[model samples]
Target: MIRNTDLYTIAQSGLRASNTLLDTTGHNIANVNTEGYVRERTTFVTQLYGGVGRGTTERVINTFAQNQLRRDITEVGEHEIYSQRTSTVDNLFASEANSISKALSRFYASIQTATDEPTNMAARQLVLGEANSLVGQVGTMSEFLKTKEEELNLELESTINRANSLIESIAKLNDKIRVLEANNSYEEPGALKNERDKAIRDLAEIMSIETRQSGNDDGITMVNLTSGESLVLEDGTFNLFGLNGNPDIQYKNLELRSTGKPTSLRLAEVDVGGKMGGLFRYRSEVLDPARRELGQIALSMAAAMNEQNRLGMDYDQQLGSNIFQLPTVSGLNYAANSSLALTANARVSEDGARDLTSADYQVTIDAVTPGAPPTLDVTVALLNPDGSPVTDTAGTPITQTYTGLTAQAGTFEKVLGGIEIEFPDGAGYAVGDQFLFQPTKDAAADLEVQMTRPEDIALASPFRVDASINNFGDAELVSTTVTNTVVDNTAPFDPDTSAFDGAGGIQGPGVAPGGLVGAPASVVFTSATSYEVRDSANNVIVTVAGATDLNNLLQQAKGAPGYPAAWTALNDYPGYDFSLQGVPKAGDTFNISYNTDGLNDNRNGLELANLQNKDVVLSSNNGTTSRFSFQEKYANIVSDIGEKAAVADISLKAAEAMKDQSKNWFESVSGVSLDEEAANLVRYQQTYAASARVLTTAQTLFDTILGAVR
Candidate 1:
């Protein structure tokens, strides 16, 4: 049996241990409602029983579960951060697409106006003004995107700083937990643990974190989240990382105070499939690519259109001038032809003279090469001065054939041969009529020519004319005509009849007009007319009929034809397609060619048709192909963003639900009820009283025994 004194001591110790257990239970109940507080319990063990000894109880609690809860909280927080960022980016993409659409509408409207009134100065100005507006719009949008990116960067930086601060706070909490656990303190620092948990939750929103358990020298345990190779160790230390232009997040490769080698933490290396990861991916991949695509579209449009407009025949008929103002960026070279000269003229006669009635000639450019000689066809209507079709002296109407010609260089050139004429009776004559050509094959040569007639003398005044002509050697007599004769030399000259006919006048039949004496009958003369040669746009390049030699006119008209080589040189840019597949890159160019029809009005039809069919293809340096249109690609981008935003919204809602469910579960397991805590507090207080009474009774017994021994 146990000794009375030992038994009393054992019972006293047992009573004290029971009261302490009740007090701990009361403390747990009190803090159950507190945030970040982990529910703790005392672990009891029996004290060893030896000779004359009784057993006592001991208690312990598991802290590992509490640490794990903190880590989970961090993960959820990080996910929410990324989700919010994605939402913001998606909205930006949608807004940008809307702006692009509006600008495109304005641009198309301007084009319609130009088509409606080709010659209206106000309409042309409006077209140019609208073009400017479109360019400005594109530029403004691009700048805005850049600005948004900058703002995102700033936000990312701020987040990183906050995360670092939280990490440091968590480390400090770990130190406190270890110290308290080792000392076997009766009271747990519930408030400090809660604060640390909250800090960890906030940190998780910025980046994913992994945790580990650590033991201190006094058999006390604590937890720490791992950041790269270093522990967010419980010693108040932290590791910070950042990203540059890329989306990859890098943590500082920190060396332990004792270790020399460095270890790094990469967000990519960790399995961080959360909102943080999404933000990084968007900034690095999506946003950058979108910006580049926009730049490419702008550059491509400005360069190609400007180049084509440069080659186009403008209202002034000049070449190499842009119809639209092109956007320019730093470090980019944009050389577009903006000069265009287009013009119109009334018809003229084939004899190189303007006749209101008989000489109706329609001048047109038959064909054009981007940088080569063009084909010009001039159709002349041979008619009498009375506007009636002219007939030859053989009682047949006079007819002439003219071939549309080309010039090798420039719009003007010297004619190398005379005009070939076809007449009745299988006879043909090559007349040296100095004619002025309006539109020319080449733009750089003289299209104008001048002509002079040979002098003539009559047979009746042969002696005086011959003597005077010989004396005045500047005049060389070619032929003589006798219009009035009737076998008497007293007949009047007939103005209505041909001089070649006996009833008419002298120099009849084969004689040219104006080659007669005394104004006898009617005659045709070899006269010259001059005119200025212009381009398709009507800008005067040179004069045609001003040439001294009549043969020069024919030679210049039939000069070598030019080929369309310059127009095909615009395929160097990436995504440049004769078919529209991808956005155009910088340096892309295009050309416009006249239709095979004799009219220049339908020249732009082919280009417009090509554009409509989406035949332009986009090429890349990697030899990849993409079928993207300016409008369609942008629209797709907007649609994709909207879809993502919708998905994120759904996900966020789901996450909130999940969070609510978790909170309910947590509350059920570790929630504080005021009634429950109050009841426990009252029970513990009574237990304290009972233990005190037992101690008092034991004290009285010990005192009585001591008195007996005395």
Candidate 2:
């Protein structure tokens, strides 16, 4: 016969296990939408088997899949964060580049207008106005870039703070989980695990990380990220935290709480690869390089333009003066040294004067030997400034050979007017006097110069003049006729008489009194003979004439056929085409000087243009103009984000599919469908009713037996 007690024990144990399974299913359904919540399952085992024991129900949950899901979730979080950051920065660059392009267009338009009306005041003013706007735009754009960098800094700080908080929370969970698992708690503490997983996901956004479960403790876990360093220990404490300060992301180093000192972390040294790794790589390499390149462009443009502006220019017939205003940029001052030489060719005058057109001259200055005489070579050019060969008024090409050439060391002083050439040791000069050089019999000349000076020729006063007049003539004195034999005090006209002689004939005062002479009524004089002044070496000395005032002379000289053009050429000229081809290594310095007149006179604009082209290179530095195009950079950022988003979406979808598969599989093994649960409920109810009926029968039999015994 079946024992009633054994049946009760079996039914009760089955009921308890079923109830637990039902609770677990309800928990999973309720928290389905919760982030980081992994579906849970109850674990059960058959009770101790007794004699004639029937089989009991049991269920077991899969924890390995839950752990893998946690890791994937962290990766998804990190990828999202990095994608957002790069996208933000890329957008900023796109905006800035577009603004720069607009400014460039406006500048070009102004230039076109200037070209149309070169001499129009309104046109010139418009050009200047547009230039001002362009410069302002550059400055504003630079400021905006700096502002964006500041924003990044703030974002970094916040990220670090949030990471630290998450890490602390994670450590706390670690401790709680270790204790709960050890105690074999009926409650799996699934909520705490979910929170911990969320924290790990948050941390992954800042840095790529890896997790390892501790072999010593079921709940203990270790976190390893970039730089091959342990971020968290198995002992439920964080070993690593980020420093909060400026957003020098490139120099980001983790600080160990135990040491309280920052440790260098090189992503390159670590194999940890993820979205956080991508962000670190971008921060350290791409973004930083872009910023540096922009700074270099700004500094080079500013310095070069400023140097050119300082050269000054003449406008509206005025003397040379600064043409452009330059802004001072901190930490970008350039120490410049330049050497220049001035030379001129002789040309003939139409008035039968000595022609300077054929006389070729050379001038040289060396910076290394400032006071030393420069090497000079002279050559005559057959052509004029108009690129046509020189011809006399007779339509025949006239040529002349220079004679009595001489050269000596001279002190060249640059004054406001121009460069003043002085004799060496001040020997060939007189107080308040001047000297000049004239060419032979031609009207056109060519001059060449070799400069060795380290500094630019400082132009001071332009011209000098001296004027004095003297007269030579015969003279006679007359007195009224006095018959009285009185001594006539009037001097008499005598060409051969001495003033001190007392002869009876009238004596002329020595060469007229006070060295003065009166004009004769009518007299024929011979033509004045031309005389030439020569230096020690018999070279004819020439004097520059016209414009007695220095300032006027400078103004007139500025745009003159030869001298002015030469001066303008030097104003902003970039000296010789020097090459670094011969330079072997760093710390090597070379000295070179060339005629600036051969180059552009306005160097500021040229330098600015050169900077735009990335032509100016610092010593030991190479500059690159290859920048990420708007479309390219933006596309890269967008593509990266889209890829990660897609991957995350796909991963979540796959996880969902897997969960469904696991649910179906689990249902086949242990899950209770509505139909099956209902059937089991009915079967259990019937069994309970049958047991009650059996008990009633037994009671009736016992009562009958007891009555018979009574």
Candidate 3:
């Protein structure tokens, strides 16, 4: 073992190892600024026979740091997308010129001007012009919002395709690495692994994914979605398909499927935490809700204007018709519904005038009777936004039973918002049938001005109260207001409507009659504290007593419980009320009749103008209520969207900070360091020189020994 030839071999191995080490250090310095290049290292081990052995090149990759970077990078992607998208929506709502609040304010202001001057054509035309302006503004905003939705779909589609391509790329890289490693004695090239990691990191920008290296095939990484669905194997990709969305087809639903698998799954019903998830979250939280809230305010405004106008008389001496055409919505059948013949038709409640909301609801049908029944009862319950049953404050599901519902033979059998269950004879509604009700979705876009001319504006009250001059004793009229008046309308003014609840629920007809019943009547005061309401027959029909003054007597007349049947009937008829101020002697008569020639009466116009401040929008059946005017509701939308935008911005900044920190951590472990590489290069250069000296010495010794042998 101590021979000169052994020394030569030893010197040769040392020179070879030193030269390889210098080459590896130079390579590290050369690729120090390269993208996706991990620092390469080699181990020099001494064999049992004392010669140096070169080990395989390995990458100094910190797996935990790499994974943490991917996670933080996905969060950055999600919040960046969310904040950017939410800012756009926020600006749309916050802008004063484009906001619904400004338009609604101007529209109501014009109505107030018209109310002050009922006979002025200029004022009436101003109202019409402002209404048209409001309608145009809302229409433009609605179309813009619709286009945003379309753009969102396209963005999502492009993102999905881009993600699928990256996944495929990663899978191919996996295959290449596996093949190369298998052919190279199971030692993968560090550069090839670098490329695979880059692909997965790129995929993380699109969506959150879990990755694990499989030791079975020389450490190939397997990728999966947040749903735990396998996305990438060692050599193949599980791609996603963009299918039509349920309830809304303009959007798309993601379907994840393996390359060779027959089955597929919806790529997560919950948040997946990336750009796609950000878009989806924005749609539900900001876009759809804000759009619906705007529509709701507009719809409520239109309904109030139309209904109030219909309650009065126009300049043409006819009952005022609707000022705006109301928007209508139909119930959308859920994809899981099995009733092919049944149709769940829907509309706004009370003919689009009262008790309407902007919330998306899921209507579930609970069939209380079998298909074969003389009386088939079905209860429709509106559930939460995501189609779960609504719970009460006490955490109990508040169930209201709709009993004694006899099935009729028409399109309106078992009706709720005109839901038709026209099955064959003796067939009833299917149990568990569900429908999605976006009642105010298209309300703003579909709103139209129905009033054609200035004279169509109803400004004159339908009734007039006149104090008689014959036997009155200084009893003065303080105020006279036509609170309610029976006019010729297309439909009867029944509070219950004798019509099914159009909010996708069923109830029986109310005890009150459908049509308002009253005739022309008069109230005659017999004393300062007593009055008798007589029909047009001039005979006393309603007698009231036990009042200290005329105002108190009027107050007593308002309540229907303690009063006689004739008193209640007479007071309710004509739907008018009056108050007196001073004292009055006996036999003070007030005549109430139709105001046939009251062309300049602006009382009803003032009443309609009062609707501007009415607390009427976004109604619910809860005991506690908080209603708002039109502008307030629109402002609420702006505030809500702005809040979401602010939150997203804050979250985005935080995520980006975490992402940078993780990147730094990964870089510190696996990234190339020029200083370290330069030091190694110098050390290896010294070793190379020393080994060369040894070879030279061994060569000189061998030559000397050869000379001596000769």
Candidate 4:
């Protein structure tokens, strides 16, 4: 059992095992700085009962740690991109020079000064200057947002290209790896396999991916996008493509298709995560909303100012014209039918401006047949910044349905949210026809001052009251004022411009249809509280029945006959409501007409300046609608971006820390450490020396036996 020859053979096996350990140690030391190189170790086994067997070399790796590292890497990648982009916008709004708030404040201050000096041309010029400055600021911010969106598009294109390259590289590696595994090339993972792992990690930096082994022992990796699609299978690779534009053509859309195939799949931005996710996320969450908010501010402000200026008489005496041309936006058609002639648009009225939010909308033609128009109904839904359907408070989709709208080409139908989803009644629409409307998207750039001359600014009301010396009655027209502008029309519509501007002034409040221009309207009190309003022709236009109080009488007069059901008057379908005080004898008469010489009257200017504090900017709070002043709205925009940036910053820190921790655990198991390798080298060298000594002793004993036998 203990023969010298047997001992020599066992010693020889020990020496071989120690030599393999030394070689593995040296290999590890040599690759200590190599990326993804797993440490190698020599494992020895015994043969039968006594002698040592050949050594097996295998890589040191932990599957859990590698997966954890991959997850952390993906998270860090997304946060890094999102944080940087969000901070850019946050910093822009935080600056005083770039902020819309400062310019807006200065703009309103100029108007405040003009109201005090109603006839001053210098004050009016200052107002125009401030308006230009404010417009410039809005344009600058909008341009910045557009630039950011363009930059994101470029980034997406680059990301897709790089991802495709990595995918191809991984597929190639898979092909080589499967070949090697098939031939039993190595006892453990070889350099090619490690290189493939590193390539996959790089891919993970762009998108969320999950890796798994082949179930049938293919030895090739299968990568899942984690967004519910297989990115790479054991046998095939998929490539990502960026469509040049989406429905609006403002940015790119991502798609996926197999290599060498025409069939493709569209990827939703919301469903994706990683660096690509970060870029789209910042665009949707920060830049888009910020741009929309800026446009809304510009649009709403312009509408309000234009409305008030139109209600006043300019120093030129001709009815004040539009001070600023209303911002016009035509809806974009999508998924169009070649024969569908229907189109859509939006308009915000002076009053409706307060109801406008920066949300995007879609008008869909349901029941659309190839040759017949959709007359049954249309679906309108508010969209998120990412073009996703906005949900209601109960989480159900908030879709506004309008029925019985005609499908007639060239005809217009009104829909919710001031949207004119007009189409003819009976013309067929193409299948999947729809329209996209962004009410304020273009306002910042499209807004223009329609007036250049300071004399064009309106600072006087068109109506005034006087104490009639012709009336022997003791009633006096004490301190009369114009509460709101008048609109005298059967079907009043302000789709774009002010309905009451220009020729609209020819029919002042209480003026009959086609009445003489600038004629005084009369109100003769039948009783102390009961008065019948009449025009120059003495046509009874408004009648009060039982009025104990002037304010109460005004409310009761809202049900006045001869008015249409869809009236848009300032007070209960009336152009303006009157507030009369004191006791007046029956048959007392007072007249109301244009304040042509009202140069000293700044009442309209006061009202216009007061618009600065009006609740005209629409906002949402907990699913309820609330209106904010321009300042509050602008401040909200700045704060929202700031909050998102802070969140992105925090997310980055968390993601990086997690990645570092996971990397530490992974490196401990598979990564080669120079110090550890050096120690192993020394240990293996000593073991080899001891093993050689054993071999030498075995040789001596065998030689002794051989000499003895001789």
Candidate 5:
């Protein structure tokens, strides 16, 4: 038979379990609003003698829900940062009235006014004033972007400090939790683990992170930053963090190292995330690119306008000077010293003068083998606006590699992007040395109107051309003028068709023109509809095969009556134009020669004014593409930024939805409910009361038996 003592012990055990259950429920209710707190549940195990009886109660928790929640939170954080930064840039560029578009229109309108009244002092003054305003506007925007970059740098530093602080705090908590867990004191150390987890979640808000729990149950949690770089190890050691570069001109990068390591590694090598990651994205994708594109427009306008100005004579009959001055190209060295020298120059390509992109290039001296026979390799990589390497459609990096560089240093020509990189042979390049080329990065800031006097504005052509006076036929030269020599090599010239591909060639893509730019030419008529354009040496530059009328013949050079034919510019030779008022007989020849009139010729200014519609900007791939105007390029930039901002906003909304859903799932599994906690309180109270009654009954029975024995 079971002893009365055993019965008393069972009742006492039941009472204690009920009391503990009540306490656990109350604790959950108390911390329902606490962040990162998981609801704790009391579980009872039955101890059997002859019958079942209540034994001990323990606390239980679900780790899976907590891990999922952390991951969702990290994704939400990344999207938020990206969305906010892009929105700022989008707003900055979206305005049309006060933005670059408006400024360009005003400046061009002023130029038109000056073109209409070439001798008007007031119109000329307005042109100079508008040019100054345009440059000022560019400078203001550039400075604003620079200011934004500095602000991001400050934010980055603060974020780094916060990340480091959380890392250290978690490591300290790890030490405490490990000691307590080792001693099997789960009750007190559970709170410490909660604190550490909160720290992890906070750190995740600033960057992407991955965590794992140790199998040994020593309370160790490992954390890895972007792309599997160790942040906090399982043994409780966290990596140290540092920064490199000034951040203002970019190249500011995160550095990381283990506690025991002497050197730090670049964070860019790893996939970085969080607030710091967003800053990097903003700097490279928005800030740096805006500045570069601005500079590219400034450079294109200044270079082309000034070159055309130089081709004309000033009002006083003197040669024209630059209207706007800036560097031909912009370049920077990774490490600058007195011994280091470099030149990165860019010019309009002969093909079409298509506009170059704002993208930068990296030149690196890599893979050096030093010995009796030293060998070095040079590699160049084209970078996207975000500072990431550009790739082909198949995702391979678009890189050019040159081997067997025996010369110490020389100009590297034949490189794409219409640029030449020159290095001084003295203090030759070292292995691993890198140079960055930002061809138009500083153009806006460096632009200035070099001309001071109104009389200095080149409004007249420096050279003139006239038809041969000895032509013997009904053919008579009607008019002559210079045309812009920049021709599109890809544009087909067909006399039968009214339309012409100004930059495209009839043969195929990128075909070189046969005519020489600025060279004199002679037009010899084989018949009324046929003529051959010859250079000074009598070599045929292009032959006009079929022409129905004078207008058709002038517009298109056809191979046959209906077939489209390629025609080179008679002189890419915009110095002059020859015209025939009447039909010309066969064997009648017209000689086109440069004009000696420099003072009273406004032909060059008129040609320069026509450049507003000419495609003179070079692109990344289109060498002779002349489609986009300077204003059009700025318009494209505005559109692209707006689209990116919209995409970022959409992504942010989606991420937020995912985060909310994850939190809801976690709450369903582990969140404390007030209604449930209240029900548990009442149930446990009743259990305690019932257990007391059982103990009293057993005691009463024992007392009665003792009295009977007495």
Candidate 6:
């Protein structure tokens, strides 16, 4: 069975196998430093029984190791994005020296200076300059954030395109590999497989993917989204994914689309684990919320300042105008399916902007019922970090549905986030139409200093108090005396001293039924033992039961008997308290009324300065009702961003460590080793030499046998 020819065949097979092994070793040595390159190993299989052994039949690739490495690559991508973006946000608010904090402090300091020197032109000018600086810086920061958002949008588009390109390349490679290995022919296409794996790794940087090996001899690998959507099919067909929205739209309003159909691929939709996921997270968690919080600050500050300034008087003795102008709400109506149009506008409610939240909301028209006044059944849902509907502790969606809304257009009838939304009456939205309301989103960018001249600043109190010129006792107005409402009545109890005309009657422009306004109610002594507080109509608004002097009578005026509960309940209830410098006679009378000296008064300026330390911002989500001063809320924003950055930095480090560990393990099993390859090179070279010698011997022996037979 062992002929000389057979020996020659066996020797030839050995030589061929040795050459293949030598070639494989050289390849390994050449590509030792290549990234994502797996070493090739020549696998030899026996030929038909009793025949020469077959040369290298295939190249062995470690699928498990490559898969593990891909996952680690994805982790690295995600952490890299998180660390970079969060750090950018943190650095923006890190310094208190020259940032928003410093600007705000300077602005308020200028106001305090103006209050100290109420009529100083230079001081008022300084306050106006500081106000301009403050608004300018806030606008700059908001614009910067808006620019970053645009950059992210462009980057997202490019990333999607890159992913699509890689997917197409991988699918093409699959076709080539499948055809090459369809019959288990000569060997697997090692170069093509390498290229495909590299493409897969590149795609992993953009978004997480799931893969499966299919087809004959594991030649065709199928890829899919983590949600089980077919990304690359066995038959070479693939699905393309994209984001649905123009660059102008905000991220929350954007949607992920697959093959022209809307799909959920937002950061919080599922466990997205790559660069794309990190970008979405940054938009929803860091960038958007920061902008909203900044807007909230601008809105609350502008509204409060304007309201207070309006209640005072400017240098011209005119009622104060708004110092800063801003839209109370921001509404974006989604394009509807039907021709029916919809419009919405939001305005600050009487409760103020401090109670507003930093989250965006969705308003959905559930139904429209016809009636004398048509009703709209609308549902509002808070968006999650990924733009999904937020859920409660019990896993139920947190939603509010308003039914029987009959208000017409031009009036904001729906209230949420301390703002009201107004809709067109007959132009109501169709079912399923949606609107996204961002109450504080653009507040900062829209904030502007409306007061152009220093003289426009309201530094004086609107109301003034005077004593009757005919009074017997020495009673004067206290500097601490403050009032929001005063009577405009022309009648006066003592026409010689009171500014108001209706000094004894409550009826006047500012006075209403059951209200304390117009002329200050007179405290008349019914007896030397007791006095009664009477209105303009001589109605006893308050009566004291105990005997008392004028000082005791005024002190008792704060509570019932001296001040009626009904008058106290009136809007902007006005009251007066006085101290007699000397004893009062039985017929002594004094006037407590409006002041026309508001033209040069600085009392309101002092009050405005006091607002710097007051709690004017509302806290959200916590069950306990709490508030924050301007600086305190700003500090919270800074701290929140810093914490997020720190956490991201730590996570990146941990992920890097994990990735390094995974890489080491993968390299140990799949990476090319130069020393090992060199040793194999020597062994295969010797085997080749030995096999050549054997072949030579077989030839020589065959020649000898032939010669002998001849």
Best by lDDT, which number? 4
Off by over 4 Å in 1: 1-33, 49-75, 93-97, 176-194, 215-238, 245-275, 323-602, 605-624, 670-676, 699-710
Candidate 5 per-residue lDDT over residues 1-710, each given as its tens digit: 55444667777887887888888888888998988777777666566453234433233455676677777777777768877988887888886644887887887787777767767778778878888998888877777776777787788879889999998888889888888776764254656766888899899888788888888877688888858788888777889677776211465678886787687877772247666676777676667777777777777777777767765566765555678756554455565422346433343232212435566777777765554344457687877654667665566766788775443334334345545555434235576677667666666776777777877777775444344666566877655543443334333422222111222111122333332321335678898878876555665656786666654233343333422122332323223344566888887787653333444456666766777767665444322233467778777778878887888789879878988887888788777889989999999999989988988987898899999999
Estimate, for each residue in 297-354, the C-alpha lDDT of model 6 and write its tens digit: 8777777777677656677766566788767554565645343345656666534656
In candidate 5, stretches whose alpha carbon ends up further than 4 angstroms from where it belongs are 1-5, 49-64, 185-188, 245-249, 267-270, 328-331, 335-355, 364-381, 385-388, 391-416, 419-432, 467-601, 619-627, 698-710
Give RMSD (Å) of candidate 1 vs. truth.
Answer: 26.5
TM-score preference between candidates 1 and 3, better one: 3
Order of models, best lDDT first: 4, 3, 6, 5, 1, 2
User: Model 3, range 233-283, lDDT digits (tens) per residue?
Assistant: 755555654555666566466677656867777765336778878887787
Q: Which stretches of candidate 6 lie above 4 Å from their native place? A: 1-5, 48-52, 56-61, 96-98, 215-217, 246-248, 252-270, 328-330, 337-341, 364-410, 424-432, 465-590, 621-625
Candidate 2 global TM-score:
0.48
Total residue pair clashes for candidate 3? 0
Question: Per-prediction RMSD in angstroms?
Answer: 26.5, 25.3, 5.9, 4.3, 8.6, 5.7
lDDT of each: 0.39, 0.38, 0.70, 0.73, 0.65, 0.68
**Per-residue CA lDDT of candidate 2, range 1-710, in tens?**
44445544555555555555555556555664666555565555544462222322222334454444444544554444445555555555556553545664565465455444434446446645665665566555455545555655556556657766777788888898888887864556777776786688567655667778899846666777645577777866566444422112323433434323445433241133344444444454334434433433333333333333222221221112222232211111111212112222221211111111211122222111112343222222232211223444555543322221232433332111011222332222112221122121111111111111212211111111111112222211111111011122234432221111122211122222212221001111121111121222222222223323222222333343432222143322111111111112221212211112322222222332332334332211121112332223233433444454455456546645654564455435433345544565555566556555555665677688899999
Candidate 4 overall lDDT versus native: 0.73
Candidate 1 per-residue lDDT, tens place, 123-217, comes to: 55655566566666666656666665676667666665675567667777777776775565544565666677667656655555555555444
lDDT of 5 at 238: 83
Question: For candidate 1, which ten residues in a row score worst on lDDT?
Answer: 454-463
Model 2, which residues run further than 4 Å from truth? 1-5, 51-79, 92-98, 108-119, 185-187, 244-256, 259-282, 285-287, 307-312, 316-710
After TM-score superposition, the amount by which residue 147's alpha carbon in candidate 4 deviates from its true location, in angstroms, is: 0.1
